[model samples]
Target: MIDTTRLLSGHREGSTLPPLSLDVTKPGNWVVFGPELTAAAGPWGMSFSANLTPDETTGIGSWTEDVFIKTLRTGKHLGMDTGRSILPPMPWYEDLKAVFAYLHSLPPVKNQVPGPVPPDQVMKMLSTQ
Candidate 1:
């Protein structure tokens, strides 16, 4: 049975470092994507996935449909021009009305994910670990 505990919560655990070689045999060395959409680190540094739940404080509870669509289309946080870039691996898509509806339907999960870490600070963060 699949555990829905952390589903769509983006919960995951492991080293952020890329594997030394392209060895798919080692599952522990790879980064796994959870239903909750957690964090990912690469040459671009660490980026924590945002909580898509309808929680007003931590998630997108306060976001309007227009804001959601614009964020996807423009890749800007809250779809604002002055907001930070949404970062990589987040593909820009069109027509998210249905997607937004479905997301709002789910139970709101209060998960405050960490902010994106710049490339320059990534190594330093790793070194201290």
Candidate 2:
């Protein structure tokens, strides 16, 4: 037997922050992370992971602290676009601050996961799972 409430709590909407999009880089590369996983997408043409690293050339170095907040606030690169929706199932609504807070606590690794699948696939992916 187990505590369903506690187990369920782990799955709560704001239980944690989503992936930070890292560069897959090479095969031998080891990404520093805890035991968790989620999906991320953007308009980059291919799948991409967030670059949490502080490296100015490769990671979020250029992103101001406000930019980090906007990632969740506007869900569109701090008003970078005017029409593109951030999509659902990812839950950008709810407590935007929670997500922002979680991401804020990360060490910024350069793991750049693939991003932004094709537009046509977006519908299929979102609709299916």
- TM-score per candidate: 0.49, 0.32
> In candidate 1, what are the lDDT values of residues 1-129, reduced to their tens digit?
545665544434442544433342254455443333465544444466766778788778899999998898898989999998886456665358978898999999999997898969989988988
Which residue ranges in model 1 land beyond 4 Å of their true spot? 11-37, 93-129
Tens digit per residue, CA lDDT, model 2, 5-42 = 43322222333554544453333433333233323333
Which 10-residue span in candidate 2 carries the lowest summed lDDT?
39-48
| True-structure Cα RMSD, model 2 | 18.2
C-alpha RMSD by candidate, in order: 16.0, 18.2
lDDT of 2: 0.52
